[model samples]
Target: MHLQEWLQLLCSHTGLKGSESEDLWSLLPSLPSFSLSTSSLLGLGALASLTAYWLVTRPRPMHPPCDLQAQSVAINGDPNCRRSALLKDENLLEFYYDDIRTAYDMFQRGVKITGNGPCLGFRKPGQPYEWISYTEVAQKAQWLGCGLIAKGCQLNTQQFIGIFAQNRPEWIITEVACYTYSMVLVPLYDTLGMEAMVHITNLAEMTVVICDREERATSLLENKEKGLTPKISCLVLFTDFSQAFAERAGKCEVEVLKLEQILDLGRQNLKDPVPPQPQDLAVVCFTSGTTGKPKGAMITHGNIASNASSVIKILEGSFTFQQGDVSISYLPLAHMFERMIQLSLFTFGARVGFYQGDITLLMDDMKTLKPTFFPVVPRILNRIYDKILGSVTSPFGRALLHFAVRRKQAELRSGIMRNNSLWDKLVFNKIQASLGGNLRFALTASAPISSTVLSFLRATLGCLIFEGYGQTECTGGCTFSLPGDASTGHVGAPLPCAMVRLEDIPDMNYFAKNRQGEICVRGPSVFKGYLKDPEKTAEALDSDGWLHTGDVGQWLPNGTLRIIDRKKNIFKLSQGEYIAPEKIENIYVRSVPVFQVFVHGDSLQSYLIGIVVPDREVFVDWAKEQGFVGSYQELCQNPDVKNAVLEDMRAVGKEAGLKSFEQVKDLYLHPDMFSVANGLLTPTLKSRRTDIQKVFQQQLSSMYNKTAS
Candidate 1:
C-alpha cells in the first residue's frame, strides 16, 4: 500500500478523524478491558498481537543466516528473543548494561579500563604518554566514593557532586565514583562563565567538586565570595594541589586533594564495596538553553542502561564493534550525547583516542587514531563539504566532481553500485583522504544539516553519516537515521525503545502535513525530571510520561523524522504569519557562499535580516579570478558582492520552497562573525538568538524600515 493510504487506514481504524483531538483514550474503548485477575492475560494477548504485526511489517534480510551466530533476533520474536530479553532485563545476571554500576563491576572483574589514554588525557609535544588502566580506575573510584562517604556522603537520597573540568579521564572517574557513592554527578561545561558555573553548582547543592585543572580551581576559589554553601566541603583538582594557591582563597573553606592524593585514599580503601542501586540518580546533565538559563536534567542508572542497550541493539545489524574499536573523543563530555557515547565505548571496550586540544587539530587526531566512529555537529560536516568543493580548480573538474556526487547519491538511494566508475576512484579519492580515509560512520546532531551536505558526505566519504535528533533532556539521542534508509532531510526512525507522537497545535499557524508540531517522546532514556524546578518539570513531562521535546518535527513518507525548527524560535510577523528562523537560516547558510544568518523582524510586515561572516576566502578568490581587484572589505561592500549574495539568497529561498513573506526582504552584512568571546554563540556553537537580536536590534530596524532594492 502507499504511505498515504496506510496512514489514512491507520487513522480511520484508530478513530483519529483529524490531527486534532486524536486522543488514545478514544481508541482505548475498542481494545480489550482488564480486571486485576485478567490483566496478565490481556498483556500477553497484546504482546502476541504486537509480535505478529512486527513479523508482518518489519524488514527482513534478502539472504538467510548460514550460521546461528550470524543471525540476530528479530525485532518481534524468535528463539534468540530470550537473549535479547536477558540483555534488557535489569534483574538478569547476563545483562551487560551500560551504566556506572556496570563499569564498576567490569573494573572489579579485572577488565583493563583505562582512564588516561594517549587520545584523551594530558599530552605534551614530545613526552611519554601516561595512562590509568581499568583496575586503577576501579581502585580510584572505590577510594573517592569512600572518601565522599567518610566526608558525610549519604545513601538512598539525592546528593550532588560538581564535576568542573575540561575533557579528561579524571572527569569520568569522578562521575563513576559519584555513582558508586549514590550521589548525583552534576557535570558543568568547563567553558561556562563563572555565573552559570556557580549557579549550577549551588543549585545542585553540590557537596563535593572534582576539578580538572588549576583554572577551574581558580574559578571556584575566586567566586567563593558569592556565598559558598557549607555542604560543599571538598575541592579537589586532578593536578597536584598548591598550598599557596589554596591559602589565597577565602569562602566556606573545604579540604583540598590532588588527583594522586584522592587515588591514594581510594587505593587504601580498595576492599570496600561500592553502594548504588540501578534506580539511583546517576547524573544531572544541563540542557543547552538557547532561550534561557540551562536546566539540570536528572538521569537515573536505569535510564542510561536502557537507552544504551536500545542503541546497541539498533546498531548491531550494521555497525558492529569488537573488543577494541577506536574512537576519538573531542565533543564536550558535559553534553549528554557525548557522555552517552563515551559510556557506550567503554562498555564495548573500545579504545578511545583523545585530540591534542581543540577542534583545529581534529584532522591530525583522526589520522593518528584512524577512528571508526565520531560524533560531530552539522557545521563541521558543512565546512568539510565546502572545503571539498573549494578544492576543484577548473569547470571540467567541477563537472566531474558534480557527476561523481550525483552518481554516488544514486548508488546510496538505489543500494546498488554495479557501475564501478573510474571517476569515484580518481576524483573522490582525494575527498576521502581529507577525513583520514578510515571514517566508517559519523553521528551528527546539535543542529540541522542540509540535505545537500548530507548527500555530499555520504557520496564522497563512502560511509553513512547518520543524523540523530534529541535534546539534553532525552539523554542526547532519541532518533537516528539508519544505514540504507537515508532520506534527503530526515532525522530517521524512532529508536527501538522510543515512542514518538506529534501533538498538533492546529490553532497555531505553523502546522504542516506530517510536518511542524511539538514532538512528544516516551522512552526509558527520558530524564527523571528537571532539578529543583517541579513546575517546569511538570510543564515538560506530561502525566503519561511523554516529554514535550519543544522542537517541531514532521514524519516523512519513509518514516524518517525531519526537524523543522524549535517552537520557541518561531516568531510572528505583522500579518500573523509565523516564521521559523532556524529553517530559513539553515536554507541560507547552506548556500556555500553565505555563513551565519540571523532572521529577525518580530513585529515588522515582512521579515528583515542581517547576516554575518561570508566565506570571504572562497569569494575573495572568486573575485580576484574574475579580475575584480580590491581587499576583502572592499569586495564585501562592492555592488557585485552584494548582488551575488542577494541572488544566492533568492535562489536558496526558492529551492527550499519558502513563501515570499518568509523570505528576507532586506539584509545588512556584518564584517565580523559571531564567536564565543563575542557572546553571540553558545559554547556548543549555537547562535544565541535573543543576544543576537538585542545586539543587532538597531541594524534590523533600519533594514526593515528601508525599502528593498
Candidate 2:
C-alpha cells in the first residue's frame, strides 16, 4: 500500500487523527508489513538524509574534471565517434557523422564555403604543373553536363559512360560531369588490358568513353571495329586534338569530340545542371575477376556519400584535416578505393596531386608535392621497407637499428618522452623526409600486409600506418583501422554507418558462436547488387539485406577483424581433417627467406605441399655460405637446398600453431615470384590459387611421388 493510504488506515484503527499522532512515528510506514523499532526508524531517516546530500552535491561520475576534454560539433544526432548499437554486441568500433546523402550535395555545400581554392594539382610535360580551384571543377562539370545533354545523352535513364584512362585532372572532370547528368560511370583500369576493357565496355553498353591518351583511343576504336564493344558510339579525347584525332574518329565511324570541344559546346548551351537524386546510380564498378569474367557492382550515390561522410567523421575524430591539405594520388582512380578517396576529399577541399604514369618518380612527386596524406598499397610499403633496410648489411648497422628501436620503445613505455627524440632525430626523420617532410599519416590496402612489416614501419618510422579491408561490392573498406588500434593483421572496424554480422558456414565449420564466420554486411555502404546479372546478385545478396562477403573472418580479442581465408579456398585431406591452406600460407610466407608460398593439398592427399619462392638476395648469401654458389635456377634444382628451405618452412608452420597434418611435408622452390603478368597473381597482389595449381601441377605431382617413394 502507498504511505498515504496506510496512514489513513492506521488513524481509523487507532481512533487517532494524524495531527494527534506522535511525530516520530511518521518515519515508519503504517502498513502491517512495516514494523520498525524507534532506533531503526531513526537510522533509516539518517541514511535517507545522507543519500539526498550525495545526490545534490556529489560530482557526476561520467563527467569528472579532467585535463583532456572532448570537443564535439553535433551534426544530425551525434557527431562524435560513437559505439554503433548494431555491432555493439560484437564490440566493433565505428564513428557517426553528419547525415549527408550524395557526393554532389557535399561538394555543393563545401565548395560554396571554402571558395575557389586549389582543389586539384596536375603535372604538364616539360613545364610547371597547374592547380584547379574548386570553383573551376564545379563550373567545368556544369559545362560538361550541358554538352552531354546537347549530345542527346539521357539523364537518369541509366546511360553508362566509360573512363578509359589513368589518373588525371580530366578524369575528375569527367566524373563530376557524369554525376551532374546522372550518368553511371564505368571506370576501366589501365592494368586490365585491352580485352578486359572491350568486354567491360560491351557488358556495360557504354554510350561514350573518355580517353586521356591516343593509344587507348586507338585500341578502343580497333575493338569497336572488331565488334567487341559495338554499343560504344563516341570517344572524347582529352589530348591529341590534331587531324589524326579527327581521322581516328572518322575511321572508326563514330562521333568524336575533344574534351575542350565538349567544354565549349556545354558553355554555349549551359543551364542549371540537374541535381542527382539520392537513389540514382552513381557508378558501375567491375570486380577484377581472377576466376572468370568480371561482375559490375552497381553502387549508388547514397552509398558513396554515406561512406565518404563516415570516413570524414572518422578522420576528424582521430586528427584534423584543414582546407588545402595535400593528398598524393598514385593508385588507379579507376579502382573504387581511390575514387572513394577522391570523392571524400571534397568535404575538406584537400589539394590532390595526380602522379604521372611512371612509378619510379613517385618519391620525386612526394618531395615536390609534400603531401600531408597518402593512400598507399602494401606492395609499395613493403618495397619502401626493403629499400631502406637493404643497406643495413653490416652487423654494426643492424645492431644500431635494433638498439635504437628498443630504446625508443622503452622510453615511450617508461614515459620518458612523448616523442622519442633520439629515434626521431637519428632514424625516423630521414625515413619520413624520404617520402615527404609533411606526411601526417598514410593508409595501406589492396592486399594483406605482414604484421611484421606493419609493426616495423610504425616502430622505425614513428608514423601511424592504418590498414583497411574491403571489396568492390562493399564500397571499398567497410572496416578501417582506428587511431588507437595497436594490433597487427587486423582490419580496424566496420564504418559507423554500416552494420556487420557474422553468419554461420557449416561445411567448413565456421561459426558465429566462435566469433568466426562468413562476413555478412548490411548498410548504406553496401552496393545495390550486380548490374544485369540477377542470378549472381541473388547468390551474393540475400533477402535480409546481408551481402555475403565470401571472405571468412575472425574477431580479434579486442574486436578487430582478421580475414582468415576465402570460403571456397579451404580444402580437406584424405584423413578427414579440414585444412585452411591460405592460413598456412599467410604464416609461412612471413619468413624472411620465403618470398611467396602457395600451399596445395587435394582432398585425396594426406599432407599439404608448398611451392616456395625464396627471397633471391637472402638465398644467394646463404648459398655462398654453404659453398654451393650458382645461379638461382641452379640452386632451386638442388635437392639439398630445397630440403633446407623445407625444414625452415616446417618450423614456421609449427610456430604459427599449425597441426602436424597441416604442415607442409615437402616443398618445390619456384625460381621467380608470382606476378600479375605471370597470371598467378591478381592485380591486387593476391595469389590465384587455382592458377598457381595449374601452373605447378607437374611439379606438385613429382614432389608427392618423391615423398611417397
Candidate 3:
C-alpha cells in the first residue's frame, strides 16, 4: 500500500480528526513507497494491527512522563530549571539510542524534517528554486540504508564510507542514513588537494565514497595513480557526470553508482530493521591537520545526539519558537559545528532553508527565508563589521559614531535597554533591514572574534551573537557563551555533562595561574577515537578518556573559559621570550584593514614580522583621502601605506600591552588573501601556518638577513 493509503486507514481507524489528522496527513505526501511480498505484508499488517489495538485500548493521550514543556530551561542564569533539570536519563546508553530513534519519533509526530531545493549552486548560477520535503528525506535515508545493507556493508568492524563533496542535501541524507545503519561517515573537504585527500582516505580505509559531483568523482578516481587505493570498491556520485568523465572513470576500474540509483535500490526494501545502537560510530570527521596529516575523529551517534539535545535545551530557554522555526543552512556540513547545529534544528522540526550560494548571496537568501538563526565563522562577521565601520567616510562622523556606539554598548551591557537606540535606529537601521530583521542570534565559531565587532553587533543589531568553542572531536560545541553572558573574549562555561580540566605545563607562561594549561575534556559528546589510527588516538585521548585539546586556555573567576593560543603555534624567540602569534595577529587584524594577517618570529633575535592582505577598498579609500594619487597596486607598495599599517600595528600593540620583543617590527604586503582555493588556508579559512611559512621563507629570512640594517 502507498504511504497515503496506509495513513488514511490508520487515521480512520483511530478516529483522528481536525488539526491532528491534518498534521498527520501532511507528513505522508513525502514518504517513499515500497513493494512487499504477501507474507511480509501480512507480518507488517499483524504488527500494525497490534499497534492500533494497543492505541485504542491503552490510556488516552499516551503522553510520556516528560514533555517539551519540561525540557525548556533557561540557558542564561535561570535558577529554577537549572537547579532541577536532569542532564541524563536512567538508561546508560539512552544518549546514543536517542539519535536515530528521536528522528523516527519526530517523523511519526508529524514533523517536516528535510526538503529538496533548487541546486542553487555557487559555481553554477541561474537555477530556479526546486525543493524536497521531510518525508522524502526520511524515506530516502531508509532506502540508502537498505542499499548499503544489500551491498554487504558490515554490521560489525569499522566500516567507513567517505563523503568527498560540498554541501548538499545528499550529504546530509547519506550521513543520517549511515547513522541508522551503524556505518561511519568520513566527510572530506572538497578543497583538499590530491595528496591530503588520498592521505585521509587511506587512513580511514573507506570502502565506499559518495562524491558530491563529477569533479570530486574524477579526483577520487584519479587517486589510483598515487598507489593509495585500498578497498574502496564503490564510488557514488551525488550529481550526474558528463559521458566523457564517466568513460574515463570507467577506465579507472572502479564501480560508480549515481546517488539516485543507490536511493532507488534502498527504497525497494524500505521495511528493513534500523541497525545498531546510538553508541555506535556515526561519523569520522577529519581534523584540519594544521600540524600534519589530518586524523579522523570518530564521532558516535550518541555524541551527536547528546550535543544536539543540549543545544536545543539551551536555545529554548532564550528563544520562543515552535516546531517549525526557520533557519538558513549555508555552512559546510562536513564541519562538526554545522552538523551539530543542523541536527539540533532537525530535532526541533525547524524548516531549514538552504542559501542560494556563497556568502556573497547570503543576504539575498536571508531575505527569502527571513531566518531566525544564522551560523557563521568569525571571518564573515569581521568583514561585516569592517564594512559597516568603513562606511563612515568622515573622520569626525566616525569618531561621533564610535562614541555613540560605545555609550550604547555600555547601556546594553548594563541591561538598560534590550532594543536598539534612537541613534542606532537612525544610523544602522538599514543594516538591520538588510538581514531581514528577524535574526535572533548570530552564532560564530572557528576562531576567536574581536570584542569590538561583538559589541557593535549587540549594540546595533539588537540581537545576541554568541561565541562557541569546540573541535571536531567534541561533536561541535563544548562551550558556548550565553545570550546574557556576551562578555569580551569569553567562551563561556562547559555544557552540561561535559567535564573540562586544565593540564598545567610549567614552561608555558600563559598557563601560570588560574589553572591555565592545555584544555583537556571528557564528556558524552567526545568522539570515540580516531579512525584506524590507534597510535595517534592513544596520543590524543588518554586511557581514562580525557582528550588533550592542544589548546591553551584559562578559566576566569566567573567560570568562563578563555583560549590563549594553540600550544603548537606559540614559539620562543632567540631572546628566549615566548610569543603567542595568534593572539597578536588577532588583535592587529581587528584594528587594521587587513583581510588576513600572520605574525612570525620563530628563532628571530628581537621583534616579529607580519604578512598581511590589505582590505582593498578600505585601503584605496584611505589612500585617496590622504591625497595619495595612485592605483591600488601602487598604493600597496607605497611607503605611506606601509606606514599606516605600521602605525596601526604599533597602536594595537600598545593597547594590548605587548613588549618590544613581541611587537611587529617588520611587515610585508600580500597581493592576495589566504583562501581554501589557493592551498594557503584550511577549508575552515584558518591559515595553514606551515604552508605560509614555507611560501614566505625567503621573505622571512630577508627580515633578519641584514641584522637590523
**Global CA lDDT of candidate 3, please?**
0.69
For candidate 1, lDDT tens digit of each residue in 1-709?
3323333454455444432224323444575544423665556456645644554443332121112122112223322111122133323221334434443443332344434332233344443334556555655676887766766666544778888877767777787787666677888765466667777877887767888777777777766645654456678888865667777643347667787776776566554564566566778888656666778898877667666666666666556665556666788877787877777766755656666657677786676556777788887888888788888879998998898888777766764322134655787776666666666777888888888888878778876577888877777777766555545677766665566667776645445444557788777778889989898899899999989987887755444567876776777888888777877888888665577888776665655565656776576776676567777788777767766677778798888898888778667667677876688887678898888888988887776666644
Quality of model 1 by C-alpha lDDT: 0.67
Tens-digit per-residue lDDT, 35-70, candidate 3: 556786788678767765655543222121123223
TM-score of 3: 0.81
Clashes of 3: 8
Q: What is the lDDT, from 0 to 100, of the residue 399 in candidate 2?
A: 88
**Per-residue lDDT of model 2, residues 202-269, tens digit only:** 78878788898788787888887786777777888888656776676686677888888989999999
> How well does each candidate superpose onto the true structure, as a TM-score?
0.80, 0.81, 0.81
Worst 10 residues of 2 by lDDT: 64-73
Model 3 lDDT at residue 24: 63
